[model samples]
Target: MSKTGKSKHRFPEFTDADAWEQRRLGEVAEFAKGRGYSKKDICSEGTPIILYGRLYTNYETVINDVDTYTELQENSVLSSGDEVIVPSSGESAEDISRAAFVQNSGVILGGDLNIIKPNETIQSTFLAITLSNGSQQKELSKRAQGKSVVHLHNSDLKVVNLSFPTLPEQERIGAFFQTLDATIASHQRKHSQRRV
Candidate 1:
């Protein structure tokens, strides 16, 4: 039995000892803080910019035609496999430390985010999924600190622990989820076409 109320699909790689490995997040990745860009810099074209607070509801990024920037302004370039995290956010304690992954190229993170590039051993999707999970979010919540506005510093993120399976297993897990996501997107497109 599983928590989802379905029969447990045993994953051979997920043993008790493998789950107990203590690995620091910094050891597995590099965290880069996003540079600040003024509101005036935004344009209707150029590059995609990801704002931190906007990721709360949407797991996948929503592109706005009106939102963009110049190549010169985009100091930090995000590739498909990189993970973006919201290190600082509004006064609400809940939104702080929320994270998302960059699924496409030509994307730049907004001021409040800290972009993380996972090493070759760890999959970006795995880290993104783990951060989004409730259990990890709770752990992050405890680490977040501030008076008026909550913030997750680099040190806080560096110490966060993550468990990983073999690289092959990670790739398999990511691929399975990618297929499911593509199917969902296809269904949504078809549904939208019918509505029109």
Candidate 2:
């Protein structure tokens, strides 16, 4: 807060905007778990699918494209394009704290993934970033449970405390991160191509 009650830290455009508000993850979002599918189910070409492992390996802030495919099953969990997904299980608690914003609908979200669907109060990309790399990541890491194989559940995520600006600010922040990730990916592709 500043002398005028606006936020002390903000983008130049939002200098006059109000301060951010605090809310629990459960207050602003609903949770679901991905279902079905596994590594053996992957096929050369079929319906696009995002397995839990992809959240740890292939994705960052946003998952706009998918290269893996599988034959669609009856009870597949599909992305609504507004979901923030985290791997439900991993070798370590810290490793399972990552998340990605699902940018396409109808893509199957495979089992062992926790899905967060934010309400109109927050942007999906922003929420994904919050859980994946922001201050809340450490909190989430602490909530994860296991010994040999750590697991994160919807209940664990519900109590997370998060702070957010207005929806417009969230959209701007989300777009900024999305563009940043795209640029990094582009450079990585070029570097790999040169190496080959």
Residue pairs with colliding backbones in model 2 are none
lDDT of 2 by residue, 49-81 (tens): 999987777877899889899999998899888
Q: Which 10 successive residues of model 1 have the least lDDT summed?
A: 1-10
| Per-prediction TM-score to the true structure, in the order listed | 0.71, 0.93
Best by lDDT: 2
The 0-to-1 C-alpha lDDT of every candidate, in the order given, reads 0.64, 0.88
Residue ranges of candidate 1 with Cα displaced over 4 Å? 1-20, 38-40, 61-71, 74-81, 179-196
lDDT of 1 by residue, 25-112 (tens): 8888888777776456667767776666557644542222214554546356454545656556556556775666676665777677
Candidate 1: residue 56 lDDT (0-100): 63
Lowest summed lDDT window (length 10), candidate 2: 1-10
